[model samples]
Target: MILSVALLVPWATGAVLVALDGRRRAVGWLAVAVLAATFALLAVLTAQVLAGGSQEVVTGGWPPGVGIVLHADMLGVVFALLSVLVLLAATTHEVLAGIEERVFPGLVLLLAGGLTGLFLTGDVFNFYVFFELAMTASYVLTAYGGGRRQLRAAMVFTAVNLLGSFIFLLSVAGTYRVTGTLAMLDVGERMAVVDPNAALLIATGFFIAFSVKLGLFPFHFWLPTVYAGSSPAVAAILSGAVANIGAYGLLRFGPTMFPAQLRLVGAAIVVLGAVSLIYGAVLAVARGDVAESLAYSAIGQVGYVLVALGVGGPVGLTAAVVYSVVNALNKTLLFLAAGIRGPLVAGAFAVGALSVAGVPPAAGFVGKLEMFRAGIVVGSVPLIVLLTLGSGLSLVYMFQMYQRAFWRAPAPAGPASPLPLRLLTTAVALLVLAAGVWPEPLLAASGRAAEGLLPGAAG
Candidate 1:
């Protein structure tokens, strides 16, 4: 029941806010209260899980194989915590900016609910359902401000996601036809015995869908435009919260549900990730706008996670998990700070830029170091070389953006709107910095989460 409440509280609160209409300023505070309550609830649940206990709840008291099942495992808890914290920070920033319309907060809550559903779902078909829930909300949120560019970006974003969803549904149908069950764990066990031809088609479909969502190489066309056009707040959510779904899908389904297929497909994924790292870094160096540069940087950083996963070992997977969490926080801070100007904002950007570049003692460095260790563990010399070169390119582009944004003098005497500052916003930035400098706890959490997913590891 508590797990279910964690999933529903956000959507339920959003519904109340929507019913209250858009004019009331009190709705904003209500939204904050709802998320704060959610944070407290999640903390309790996380503590319970860490104490060697787990919870599972089936909707409508139906059987596990037949009904929607939500479970609180280590992996889900980590992501749920990340989602809640990021949304809290985003909501606070929006409120302080005086743009706290009812719809904005409502949509943020709705987005959080959808992600919760996605993370908690234990059934394959239910995963697709929650995936749609999250995607649909994200599509609308991306275009919430509704300008020409935003509308255009939203169209591309919607079309691509819808197509991906359709393909995912087709895969689900294929899997069901072969295995006759939608339970994720059961499907994984049965898939090897199913007809190879059908399995191949289904696996290909799932790969395409996940890759599209992750914005891998050729399928990533929608990302830059969408990031550039959306509000910085919305951009932070998309980059931080939404992008994790794709990585999660790959981590959850790829190894467990489609092991044979992953073995066949892993090299391609590794290649795509490497290409994205170099391509995105190069493009960032050429980009002029702050938002666009961060967008490209996100591509590169996510690529690192992909490459780590493609290595396909306990160490590699652990590194990927750590990288995903660290990258999400770092990217969110960078995108949020990109919207800021003035001396204080400049300092924020400098700190965030160094962190993103994998500077020493930051969270990003922990992830980078782990990734390098994983590459060595796998004995992949070429990958080691690529990772080193990728890190160098990342530093070059990140420092270039920093020099342009912070070091360059403001244009002489023409009036420009000053960047807003609020305590909540600064706190969020500092928290990210703190996590980077002292990341042992997050690293331990990520390692435990990865071990829970790995075969023959203690749960």
Candidate 2:
């Protein structure tokens, strides 16, 4: 029941809100109320699962062999919680700023529902179902501002992601053909016996699909245009919530279904990460536009996730999870803060900057600390050096953006932000600070999440 409510509540409310006037305060509040309720259910489900164990639900009460499986483990739960929190923050920021579009609130809820379903499902095909649910909404949401620039961004996003979706579906088809099963566990077991060549090809497909989603080096052409083109709320959702799909997909599919292939290309993956780290940071420092620089910085931040994945053990995977969470929180705060101005906004941006720089008392420091551990465990001197360079570059670009965006003498005639927007950003900033000060929960949760990939895995 808890599982069902967690999946259905946002979906049902979003369906109702699609036709309503979300610009009105009452309807906007309704959207927030629905998200809050859904979040509370997820919290309950998280506690339940932690106390007990993973929960599994097969639709139609059919056997696991015959029905779609919805499985919730620590990995799924932690990601779902993080995604919902980001959606809530972005939505609240939009609402408090006076929602302009009728579809803004509803689309966000639908995106939430889709994300929840995608994260929780155990069936790969069902994964595709929920993926589309979210991507379709996001494609539309990218066009939210309804201008030439927003529309063009939507077009690029849609075109590239559609091609990615096609690649993913083709891979799915091949997996079904070879393994004769869509259940992740079954696929994992069968993949060992499947033709090695076929498996490697399919793994490459999955890798490319996720890489495009993440905007990694070489496949990142669409990112800056889309991110800089979209409005702040939409940009936040894309970077903070939707981007998780790619990272989570790689973690789930690679280790569980394509472990051999992952190991085979682990070093290659690290090289790509290193290149992305260098390329993104260098370009970010050169870009003048605040959003564009952050877009490139985002490219760089994800390199750390790839680096940790390449390390390929319990410790490295744990570092990957921790950094992913921290990056999400940092990007969400920074993007939302970009839209608002007045007292306190500069402080909020500074917190985000310091976090990205991996400075103390921000969650990003903990993330980098874990990455350092991962690098040491792997005995990779190059990884350590690359990390140092990345950190220094991040500090340079972050302070550069802060100076230009926030520290420039107060705007002469710009609109002042409402208190709610200021308060929302401040709350997220404090959350980042608190996580750094007391990181036990983040560390433990990420450790447990990595354990899902290999139970009893030791660093």
Candidate 3:
């Protein structure tokens, strides 16, 4: 019942918003209120899943194998909550600033609906359905400003990601043809008996699709222009919320559906991740624009996730989960802060920068520590050295960008930022600090989420 409500509220609200005049403050705040309600419902659902176990419901009371099953476990619920919080924050930020587009509020609500469904559905085909829902909203959201630059970014984003989406659909077709099922659990169970050659090809297709979404080193050409061209709120949603699809897909599909293939290609994945870290960091140092720099930095951040995944164990998986959560929060804070200039905004940016560099007193340090622990557990000296060098490069670039952006006088020419926006960033920075100082809960949650997917652990 809770699972159904969690998925429906945002979806229904979004539909209503599409017909209404959302440019009015009432409509916009109503949208925010609806999102807040949805977030509350999801929070309750998360607590229920954490306290009891996975909560599942099949549509129309049909059998699990036939009906669409909505599944909420520790892993799915956590990412869902993280994504909603980001949307909530971004929406709040936009509301305080006054929405420009008539469709802005509706689009955001629809995007939330899409993201919620993607995180909860148990079927791969439903995953694709929700993924398209989210991506479609994002495609329009990218052109929010409707400037020539924004239109170009949206076009490129649509073309590149549409290709990735087709590849994903191809993989889905292969999975179904080979396994005779669209349900993820069924696919996982059956993959063990399927021909290795077929399974490997399907896995590679998924890897390519998600890599393009994550802006991984090789498939990342479209990201910089898009990020640089979009408005701040849209950029935050893309980096902080939408990008979760990639990390979540890799985690779910790799461990749950293709564990054997993951094991076989673990080293190659690690090599790719290492290259991403080096390439993203070096390029970030060279870019003059903050958006472009952060674009490359986003690339560097996901490398840690892939590296941890390649290590392939309880420690490695937990590290990947932890890093994903922390990175989402850090990016949300930084992206929002970058658009605002005021007193104490610099401090917020500093917190985000330090977090990215894995410095003390920020959530990112916890992620870095686990990655270090994963490297040690794998006994990979090369990984350890490479990770350290990546951190060094990160610190140099992050601080250099910080000093240039924040330490300089705010242009007397530009309008001052709103108090509400400044407060939002400050609050996010404080949350990042609190999580770092008291990381036991985040650590335990990551471990439990990983265990739910790991071999010999509870599902």
lDDT for 155 (candidate 3):
97
Please give the TM-score that candidate 2 achieves against the real structure.
Answer: 0.97
Model 3 misplaced regions, further than 4 Å: 409-417
Model 1 regions more than 4 Å off: 22-24, 100-102, 409-422, 456-459
Winner on lDDT (1 vs 2)? 2
For model 2, residues 11-122, the per-residue Cα lDDT tens digits are 9889889899988988888888888888888988888777777888986789887776789888888899999999998888888877889988899899999999998999
lDDT, candidate 2, equals: 0.89
Instruction: Assess the local accuracy of residue 125 in candidate 3 as a C-alpha lDDT between 0 and 100.
Output: 96
Clashes of each: 1, 0, 0
For each candidate in turn, give its C-alpha RMSD to the true structure in angstroms.
2.4, 1.8, 1.3
> Distance from true position, residue 256, model 2, in Å?
0.9
Query: On a 0 to 1 TM-score scale, where does candidate 1 land against the true structure?
Result: 0.94
lDDT of 1 by residue, 91-183 (tens): 766665655344777777887888888887778888888888889878887886678987887898899989999999999999999999887
